[model samples]
Target: MELDDVDWKLLDLLQHDGRMTFTELAKRVSLSAPATTERVRRLEQAGIVTGYAAVVDPQRLGLPIEAIVRVKVRSLDTPRFRERVVALALVRDADHVTGDDCWLLRVVCRSMVELERFVEQAQRYGDTTTSLVFSSHVRNRPLTRAVVEGTAVD
Candidate 1:
């Protein structure tokens, strides 16, 4: 909700390292451990801090092939397509985007053959275009107050 400078600092610190203990977080934000815990709990209750997760490397897990698959779903197949996409294990992320593509999917596979199979399955719903991801400059950058307030500059 109404976050002060201390809250913002706590958010920044937590985003960088979610595993940081309450004592460490309190020290960084200049608050007591109990205060820091209370603030973090409030943030969670307010839905500002959604969840904590570990970021893993796809390549290290044997799913090196990454692809962006854009699909323009057929009018009648929209519901079915959405359901099917969710069940797809290879789809790491899916966005219902505007413009030419109805759905943009971030898919990862073990090899080109697996990717091709995924494309074939997607084609049943509508026209599909797939592109392999060569590199990613920004994967998951932490959000800060400046960025959220539109005051951040590159």
Candidate 2:
């Protein structure tokens, strides 16, 4: 789908504030309320604007520590290992990457004790290194320009 400037602006605004009303969104992006509503609907129909969500503060809600775990699998060719990684709940994200580490994970945990337990469960997956994230320099945002350009993101 070819997205124009208004579409891009809509995406940009929505990413920051997902609950913005159609009227307010229209004013911000300089579009009529009806037009903005229609565009958003189209974006949804095309699966561009797939879904809306509430952003939760992990820390404020009790989950404080964020762990970056680097995992080096014994065999990348092993399908079982891949399956295990995917099925693990503590594994927020699992990627087969370069260098010594075959997979990297970004996991959220309540405390260091929980993080240690997560690591222990992952011990069978080869070697693991865990790092705690104290804070983020930039909050998680969205792909504003890509929505406008109608291009795939990397």
Candidate 3:
């Protein structure tokens, strides 16, 4: 489905504030509330707007230490390794990756002691290379002008 200028604006606005009301959204896009609502529904149906979620700060919630864990698993242990990773509550994100690491995990813990415990359990699955994240310089970037131009994101 081809998206128009209003559709692009709607997407951009929604990305910034998912909780914005349909009336507010319609005002920003200069459309009737019903029209904006229908457009949003269409976007959802097309899998463009997958889901709305509130972004939370893990550090503020007590999970201050963020670690990037690179895991290299044995071929025979892949299934068990995945199950173990998924079962860990501290694991915020896990990616099945190429190269030396079979999986890359983003883990957050309350302290060094907590991180050490998690790593001890994680090592059972594979050889692990872990790095502590000092800070995030760039994250959750906004949609680019390409979307407004009706071009695919690079």
Best by lDDT: 1
lDDT digits (tens) for residues 1-154 of candidate 1: 7899999999999999999999999999899999999999999999999999999999999999999999999879988998887468889999988999899999999999999988988999989999999999998799999998899995
Between the candidate structures 2 and 3, which one is better when assessed by lDDT?
Answer: 3
Candidate 3 structure quality by residue, lDDT tens digits, 56-76: 999899888999988888888
TM-score of each: 0.96, 0.80, 0.90
lDDT (Cα) of model 2: 0.81
Better of 1 and 2 by TM-score: 1
TM-score, candidate 3, is 0.90
Candidate 3 stretches greater than 4 Å from native: 145-154
Distance from true position, residue 122, model 3, in Å? 1.7
Q: Model 2 over residues 1-154: C-alpha lDDT tens digits?
A: 9888888889888888889999999999888999999999999999988898887777787888898888777884347766765567666677879898887888888878988887876667688898887777876658868544577564
Residue 33 shift from truth in candidate 2, angstroms? 2.2
lDDT of each: 0.92, 0.81, 0.88
Superposed by TM-score, candidate 3 places the C-alpha of residue 37 at a distance from the truth, in angstroms, of 0.3
Q: How close is candidate 2 to the true structure, as a TM-score?
A: 0.80
Model 1: which residue pairs collide?
Answer: none
When summed lDDT is taken over every stretch of 10 residues in candidate 3, the lowest stretch is: 144-153
